[model samples]
Target: MSIEANLEKIERLTSKVWRSYSKEDPLGHLSFNEYDYLKAIQAARVPIRLTDLAKELEVTKPSATNMVKRLERKGLVLRVSCSEDARSKRVMLTEKARAPLESESEIYTIIAQKLKVHLSEQEFDALNTLLTKALR
Candidate 1:
């Protein structure tokens, strides 16, 4: 296949896999962007400030605020007033977000297992390396 065709195929296959995995799960309601924001908040050492989250996600502060609002409405996150800076709010994951976060990791593990079963160890390692490089 041509490069463009191969890229398109990859996108389709990934979407198919994700859809299949998420179809019965509540996490399916979340967009990839929404999941990313939650994942970032979960990875933080403490409840993260909005400005810091924007920096970590490499998005504008306003963009991060908008996404936080969406996640808040979905009951996945909360914006608590920062203790040190009362004017600034910190993003935190709500109890509701726990299952989706765990489910996301499970989806990745399933994908990795499927790939490892189909490819030789070297091919799998090379694919992982190439994908990491390509993403960067």
Candidate 2:
């Protein structure tokens, strides 16, 4: 297959996998925007400033603040005053966020296990290497 054709196939497969996997998340009960915000906080290795999150999410400061407040109410995230900057606040994932994150991870693991039926170990390794390079 041509490179373009392979890329198209990968895109299609990824979409299908995500759609199917997301159905299993109770968090799917939340709006897509809310889920996205929560996922971003969970993915961040460290607490992130509200302004930084706004920039990362391409949202306004008020919008980011509102979303963080909602997440805090849901017990998925906590907003704390930044120690380094008195006026700024940072968002961190709460223990409540772990269940949903772990559930999502399990879904991905299941999808990967199913895909392994079609891909050999070497093919999977090559695909991982290529994807990492392409992402860079």
Best by lDDT: 1
lDDT of 2 by residue, 50-108 (tens): 99999989999999999999988888888999999999999998877768776777666
Q: Which candidate should be chosen as best, given TM-score against the real structure?
A: 2
Give the root-mean-square deviation of each candidate in angstroms. Answer: 2.7, 2.9
Candidate 1: list runs displaced more than 4 Å. 2-4, 43-45
Q: How do the predictions measure up, each by TM-score?
A: 0.75, 0.78
Sequence-dependent TM-score of model 2: 0.78
lDDT for each residue of candidate 1 in 24-111, tens digit (9 for 90 to 100):
7766677889988988999995799999999999999999999999999989999999999989999999988976676677778776
Backbone clashes, candidate 2: 0
Q: Candidate 2 local accuracy as lDDT?
A: 0.83
lDDT, model 1: 0.87
